[model samples]
Target chain A: MIHNLPPGLIMILGALLLPLLGQRLSAWGALVLSSLSLFAFWTTPDFHTVTLNLFGQDLSIVRIDRWSWIFGLVFHLAAITASIYALHVKDTKQHVAGMIYAGSAIAACCAGDLITLFVCWELTAVSSVFLIWANGTETAYRSGMRYLIIQVTSGVLLLSGAIIHFQQTGSLVFENFLGLEPGQRGAISDLGFGPLLILIAFGIKGAFPLLHNWLQDSYPNGTATGTVFLSAFTTKLAIYSLARGFAGLEELIWIGCAMTLFPIVFAVIENDLRRVLAYSLNNQLGFMVVGIGIGTELALNGTAAHAFCHIIYKSLLFMSMGAVLVRVGTTKATELGGLHKSMPFTTVFCMIGGGAIAGFPLLSGFVSKSMIISAAGHEQMFAVWIVLLIASAGVMEHSGIKIPFFAFFAHDSGKRVKEAPWNMLTAMAIASFCCIAIGVYYQPLYDMLPFETHYEPYTAAHVIMQLQLLLFAALAFVFLMKANLYPAEIRSTNLDTDWVYRRLLPRLFAYIGKLVRLVDSLFRVACLAMIKRFLNWLSKSCSAQGWLGSTWSTSSMAFWAAVLLGVFLILYYL
Target chain B: MKTKDDNSKGGNSSSDASWLERNVNVVIAGLVIACIGSLIAQLWWAPLFAEKHVEASHVEASHDDGTHDETSHDEHAHGESSHDGASHLHPAEFAVEEVFGFEAMFGFAAFVAVVFLGTGLRLVIMRDEDYYDS
Candidate 1:
């Protein structure tokens, strides 16, 4: 029975009991529930499907396979770490949100049918917003509302796509929509209307470029520890779904490249360190999208590996930023500097995350990102390879140096606060450890990939090229700083795609409303003028001075009437 | 650049700057050396790349003989491998990747270009801290 239980249901159902433990023990309760669920998930047999017969249709409510297993395991790890991160938060709502959010994401990845995936997708959307709203500020409330609308809209699209797919194909099984197998390539032409909508749904959730502003708008607004939970699940869930459903779509390559390139520039000028990380997260997803587009065994492995490592290091990065937010009360680069003096441990963890993300030799990024770049190189995609190279240096600039330098070192703002709370430190340390361990020894991660591959990441050619790329990028930073060419960290709002909805769309509606009111007032005045003219004529005629109102007018009226009668009689005689 | 001295006069427990703050030059020097070291490494590994290219077509096509093979290369691509003389993908596909200081130069140039672009972008997108609020 335990083996049959859905992998993430334990934590989802167990979240209700968390409040019973009271706020103090709820974090620990969350940790225990996730651990138990992980154990249950690990023991479930391969290719297992737990189904329910409802309305004469069999729904694969739970399925454990290679793809889902990797995601499931990582989701559990993230949940446990985030629970540790939030251990000190006495707010029961945050813990509940984190658990249900993490659980639904796990369940979403394991869902075997589109219907099951849709339910869990919406669940993740609904449950995760509380993490933002738990901040209990007006800005947080607004950002959370935006987040909820976009996410639920994506879920709605997913459901609508599934319904259409069911009507056309008579199957809701969540597999490749394009019917392409490993080593096969496909184009957007291969997709039907149903799958196309589903792809957009995935694209939105994955934060594909223009669809990405909700992430930057909402993630930074989440409460300190809450952002840690927010970082791990939702977007990665989209990556999993895309890999399962839309891998090998040709347009994804260009889309992924665009996704990778634009964000790094934005990250360069972003003030909020968390928002910078959010942009960095978007850039990393681009690499995975490119891999899925490649649609080869080795490329797929790279995607899986990159996702695993990214989850850990990203959580680590966010945890460090969260610690800064906790102590300094802001993550704005203009307001933060010299934090390492007081928070040495967080500084170290942040640097580790920075280095790993930069794809330093032996780090998790070097191991995983190289695979995708190499996959492109192997395909003889010279342009794609070169773009990936530029993006690597770009990653070095933002996550590697700018993040660590501005937040922890740079010029000291001299806010020497105490170290991060013990639980927070513990969580960051765990994530940091995972980053280093995976970088140095990656066979375990490789073993978890969906396919067998002898594709190596540590060849001398690969390492030297990667090192050359990152080191030179760092060298460039040093030169820029010495020359005072690096843009000074200024407190400013950087407008991105969110401006369309937040500013342009609202202003457009207001203008339309103003136009409607103007027309209404003009129309009312026109009608009133005509009415007043008629009334004026009636009032004048009624007065003694007007022809119809005067008593002598009766004689003239009788004469006119007689003339009319005589003309009528003449006409009748003729 | 605000020196460590400028920061020494703020808050409790920050009377003296840390070793890193006082030695910014050392970090720069270290980065330069590491960059040079990476360049030297490409030179050292150029010969290994040579041998890999000669045997790349067969070794990478289907199996690994343990001498740097990508065994999982797409089988479908084999039919189209007429030009590169290799059935599987290798790290050094283009002659540009094999240049001695190509990655180093590209990294430096790319970094500068992105930073400058970001500065230019700031002119267009950057706004007051309360731009949205007001």
Candidate 2:
């Protein structure tokens, strides 16, 4: 509202001015602009809305409430840190794209109406693709293409759903589709067709189970710095959208459970450390989705809180990997080892990020993730609680133990590289600081929740259990290492759901094309053979020397004439 | 690979190996201590940490106590984790969450199982680095 415009639009429009700032200074310009937008967002009064009447319908362009505020503030933080991280890059396009993408996501969360949300949603898709393409690899470009298609398809679904929703409800206000208030439970059956489509739209963006391949597919393909940006906004925005629109939807619990469970296994075999982080990202999102599904005040608070903390720590993890990628030219676990010998600071940062993700005590993940698990326990969903517990152990296995263990401390690949750039280090340090700060002093974060909560994260039982879970998981790693039961880090591509499109479906279509060609060739060959046989017979029959066309007809006629005369003579004698 | 690694541009070209690499045993020892410490901590904190006797805790509690030898909590100053009549599927005086080393063992077992599953998963899903491209 600094210029009586949406805070996100401010960053988006201000991004235009960034190119004028020149390549060298544009990154700093972005940092400044996001900070400005954050300040403007901070000053916005609670529940403020800017509605525009458009063609007989009210289009709410901007709305600032508790939900958007928290998301917006975190988006701003991400933008500033990402901008700082990208300061070493002279590419103006990445900066511009980064700002616009982050801005649109912020705008999308703040959007009061579905139309506005849809516009920003598409903007996020269009703008963010450049980050992947900036890698300048064929793999990255193709991955970006797939990413754009899926994201644009999500946007299309959102728009179509919005139009239908308007027809049915005569309002495009983004609210609970089931018309349930926060903390009120509802079933998926209660939703209209529009809401279901909208849920899918959110689900695609949210990386919901089967719809999740794009996240693991594209994120690892992005530029080193760009993946850090990619990790922060898109899925969390979907989590926010789902929380706003589909909270308490009963089916989300199972979907979230599935979302959490599979990624850890995929992460285990994944050779690309970046892809491992991507899978880990999906797994983390599952916890937030489950929180939103539970639809209790504490659970919702957990979702919001987890989202906030996740953006920082996940960004930190990605940043650390990006550092590795920048220095060593690969984040392949097989190629990366004994990095602590050279890049000790980077190694430390990576471990901190890993520890944060694994929900070590007094780390950001611990404080935030527990809320969701406790909510599950509070609901007494024993199976779900147990699954979540297993997932936690899985998280420890992959992100906590494997990422740090293999990347920094395992057998010496003997690659000696410098520490990350000052700007990158600063960004990681800032994010790391935020992780610890939030973990220790969480009340301020708790205050930003949409609902009131006295949910405590530091209970004696909770801490001990979490410690036991994590520490023993670490011990298991040691045991596995000692017994040589741990899987060796091998250079390989691990199959995931993306196999459907990237491999299976494309191969299916290719086979289909081959089958069509096979059939067509066989038919043509058979027809030609038949035609040749017919012509040969026709030629044989029409030839002058052939029996049918020859003078043998005359001989047969003479014999018939003699026989007829003999018969006549006989008749006369009788 | 070694040739590529030889391009050590900056930051401690002097050190051939890190202290961590030299003292891997020390790190492992620390982890072992932490694991043992966590189990010991559970035993100590079980009394003060016992929360409500959540109804569902009994099911897992009873199952856990079935392997009573593995579970480290026999000295139940509080009743929640006690194996006597309290560990039955019936409503316990305390929650099953207080079961000493239960989470620890579960975490250890689950981690091993997940890693083994991952190793097995490699048989089905792992492919050459350019599997998709090829």
Candidate 3:
């Protein structure tokens, strides 16, 4: 019974004990425990669920719903794959942090109230930083710190909103909160603020514009296995949270539109395969966020299904890059080529993942991605739909084709290397298969929708349109390449939004520091000059020839002291 | 057509053959079939799976608007209306139903199985351990 044994308690117990086991066993053991817990939750009868009260609030610590189940299932599966992938890793800190990070996401999904969500939310922030730190490079360390600061700030906002909402409404139910009531300014001033706070919290995790710098900054810098874990949980969790909290909020449509557009152009020119995928991840989240914004039963279903499929496909893409990096010692498209000769298996998996991401006619992405695109159309948001269609073409260019085309099949770099490790390949294979399975037979995904919609994804028109998009995009790539108009892969940095923090902000701080130092020095000189001037006056005044000469200095001192004391007495009395 | 150096550079190509040799049509076909097959199966399974979920909730409560407009109008015209209150759920009695339950779990299991089996097959065929790095 989950009620009798709350999963959070089990998780806390596991988090505490797992680290005590030796390094090798700790990660694997924690993963096994999480999987077992998932099984326990799954087998436990829905009618016989548990409730627990913590901190003067009764909450459903083991609630079962389509939303929670979707997140929980992926979290557990991701944990298993991550643990297996990290088996060769010797970093105990990363391993422990990963387990804690994943456990928190699962715990959050199971949380019934805002209070519970806040606790798990903060926990996820604290644990995930180690993944970035696991890179053990200066860039990674700095990026990890930035990630922690943003994530914690997001949590703080959510917590503040939650506390305010509770004080105003006298309840802490996390779901279906329609912001602050009007005309009341006690705690929660507006409904918009509550969703805003939660949206910002999710935006950082979801990698929304402005708040998304951390993903591009930190993901590529993490260890391969850590990146795999990074890909699976945090952003997707935020999308789930947004879907739960901010569905049908119209502003999200524009926000989603912006998110969908910005990443593709960046991905088109990006050098690092992982960074490209990071941008693609942002693009994918845009689709889900748009779905949340649309808030139709079909759209929400699309969001959930997209999250599910996105996790697998993105991870597959990352794993392929990881595999390439394993052999070639780099993931830069410019530096990598002819990998297909030695790593044919990884290439095959990558192409599958690429196809899925590009929304190829019969891949997982097609099934879920179409739902959001259609929702936009259904809502008569013709502009958003058109942009999304353009972005879909960009997805294929940057991810579906470019990633593999450059890394594995471009001008051969003449580097001969072996395939990825068995474990690594195994994980990639699993993820790639899911990417395709979701597309080919989308009915299972459609039926799992929380709301019923009669639209079919496989209608001839939909498939034809999608195929045309992919074909035309491929043709465009060929046309550009033939014309030498396509951007050539270069061995240099391509700036992302993170450039704000990475370059501009730090430079701004340094410039401010320099200006402050100059002002400080100038003030010191001016103070010295003022002291000299005062001394010159004092010398004349205190000398025998001066008005207040040494002959009369004692009387002058006494007079001044008496006047100052009198003034002080008056001021003190007043 | 160009410089001697350019001709030498062009002739000394070692990377081109490996990529062309590696495409090996058979590998591409296998990947296509596996990916397409699983996607179709999952698509077919989603809706039937979701329908099973809707059946579980015991009640689909809908309160009918039983009072006709003429009757309400007559009562209102006679000034016979007495009660005036907004319908609200009791906080203690409010319950939220799980709209879609095992549907996600079923989908997840199917996803995991399909991925593992497909990748496992690919690994068997590829044979080389470091298939991705090269």
Candidate 4:
């Protein structure tokens, strides 16, 4: 019966009990719930729908299929690993918020209808903000608020899009929008405005191009352990939504292309190593998006597989950086270097993550990412293929080279710190093992994909070509570094698109406030002057010294009354 | 060997220096050899596998159904060819995949372009940490 419950509810309900439990018990409970969810995911029959009748409309609260199953599995895995990483954290609120956040993402993944999905979607936005707040810094608080507003806006769009779609189609069963037929001219032209709104909603969460600043802004500012959880879920869930709703939509190819290319530039010069990884995370998502855009069996398989591997490795990267943040009190590349000497285990783990992300010959990225690139080549998308190739090298530069090189192996910053805690190292080790296991023996991963593909990743040609690209990219890094052409990390903030909201709008509001205050004071001054003049006239004419205020008031009153009466008589006669 | 106490004192111990300091040449040499070996293998061995894979994939495509058969013998045979020049033959495939050494060049060029362009953008957008504070 417990297994029969919606998988996400187990975590959500379990989170409610977290505060009452001891710290150790809460951590263990979080892991247990996540593992139970994974078990539920496996046992739940494919395409099995659990429906409830509400207001004469059927709502599918849980739908287990290969697509949702993959996402559910990864979400649980993220929850477990992130929970393990955060085991040392004294903050119970973060544990509760994290569990709830992970639960909401899993719920959204399994929801069979748009309404259920919308509810879970908003829940994710509401719950995840606490992770940001857990940092207890003023900057974190502000960033968390901005993150909430954007996430809620995304949920609103999803709700509106769902309503309009249901009205038009007379159904709310969640599936790919019928208008998103393969090889369509454009998503907007084909689906009209309704699905476009939904797409933009996912795009905002997905960190698509200009809608991406929320990720870079808030992710780094979360509590050290909190960011590992933050890194895994939100964008990946959005990717799942896009895969579910808009696969094979050709426009996504270009959008995904842009996503891959733009982040590299920002990540290159970013001083905060966590922010660099955040940008790297964006670049990684691009490959999945492109796969969804292509929408072939192989491409979809690539997307699912890449998402799985990316969750582990990206979190591992985050975990290592988090360890650095915990021990050294900073994650800035400008401040961190030669950390590997003190934190050798973390160094090895970071390298594994970096290698996995860079698509080295025996890593998860090689097995997964090549599928998307190969899919592009097979589709004759030469332009996208070229951009992807370039982005691959770009990935090597930032995630592969810059992250480890700067944090652990570059100039010795001379700040010796203890190795990461056992729990953190253990979590990183598990993730590192996964990165290698999935890379070398990929059959298990392939079996779990949404589609059956016989695509072989480790071809002699593929391996050699990938090696050539990665090694050559490495060479370029060395050349640049030796020549001093590489950008030096500095303690500064780079203005991103968030500047529009965080800086420009607030300053504009302040300027308007000043103008309004000036006008208000002027109006007050004029009104006071008129009152003063009126008082002066009163004193001059009607005060004790004036004629009206003199002792002859009775005679004047009589005279005025007589004159008024005479005038009234004359007018009446006329 | 340095004791744990020495590490905890947060002194600028020489041990904190990167592994690259002592082994930079060996690492660089090893990487160079790996790159050259990849180039050699790509030219010498990969083409033969590529041809076999192309032919094998062609056969598989003819009998292709929607469902993937994991135990299919031909699929395993095709797996040896690597990722490039596989069965989902499109007319306008990447020309670089057919040529040897082009990927390395392209990768190097891409790295340069990305770094150069990124550096240019940095000049425009880079600001002090308190840019928003004022």
Highest lDDT scorer: 1
The candidates, ranked best first by TM-score, are 1, 2, 4, 3
- Looking at model 2, the pairs that clash are B80-B94
| Interface RMSD, model 3, angstroms | 20.2
| Prediction 2 TM-score vs. true | 0.89
- What is the C-alpha lDDT profile of model 1 across A1-574, one tens digit per residue? 9766667899999998999999899888988988888888888888888998778888898888999999999999999999988888999888888889998998999989999999999999999999999999999999999999999999999999999999999999999999988768899988998999999999999999899999999999999988889889999999999999988887888888998999999999999999999999999999999988887776778888899999999999999999999999999998888888889999999999999999987778888887788777667778888888889999999999998999889877867689999999999899988988999998899888898765567666667877888888888998999899999988899999999998999999999999999999999999999999999999999989886787785788899999999999999999
RMSD of each: 3.6, 6.8, 14.5, 6.2
Writing each residue's lDDT as its tens digit, candidate 3 over B1-134 gives 12354345434555357636456456455544543544454354434223222322223444232322221111100001111321111100011111222222322332233223423433333223222122
Q: Name the TM-score of chain A in model 2.
A: 0.94
TM-score to true structure, per model:
0.94, 0.89, 0.76, 0.87
Candidate 4 lDDT, tens digit per residue, A1-574?
A: 6544567888888899988987767877777877877777777777777888999999988888888888898888889899889888878888989999999999899998999999999999999999999999999999999999999999999999999988888888888884443333245467856788999999999999999999999999999989999999999999999988998888888899999999999999999999999999999999999988887777778899999999999999999999999999989887788888889999999999999999997889988898888777666678999999999999999999999999998766777789999999999999999999999999988898887667677655567778889999998888888899988877788999999998889889999999999999999999999999989988987878877686776788899899999999999999
Q: How accurate is candidate 1 locally (lDDT)?
A: 0.87
- Which of the numbered candidates is closest to the native, going by highest DockQ? 1
Off by over 4 Å in 4: A179-186, A516-574, B1-12, B15-19, B49-92
- The Cα error of candidate 3 at residue A374, in Å, is 1.4
Which tens-of-lDDT digit does each residue in A316-356 have in candidate 2?
A: 98998999999999999988877887788877888888888
Model 2 chain A scores worst on lDDT over the 10 consecutive residues at A453-462
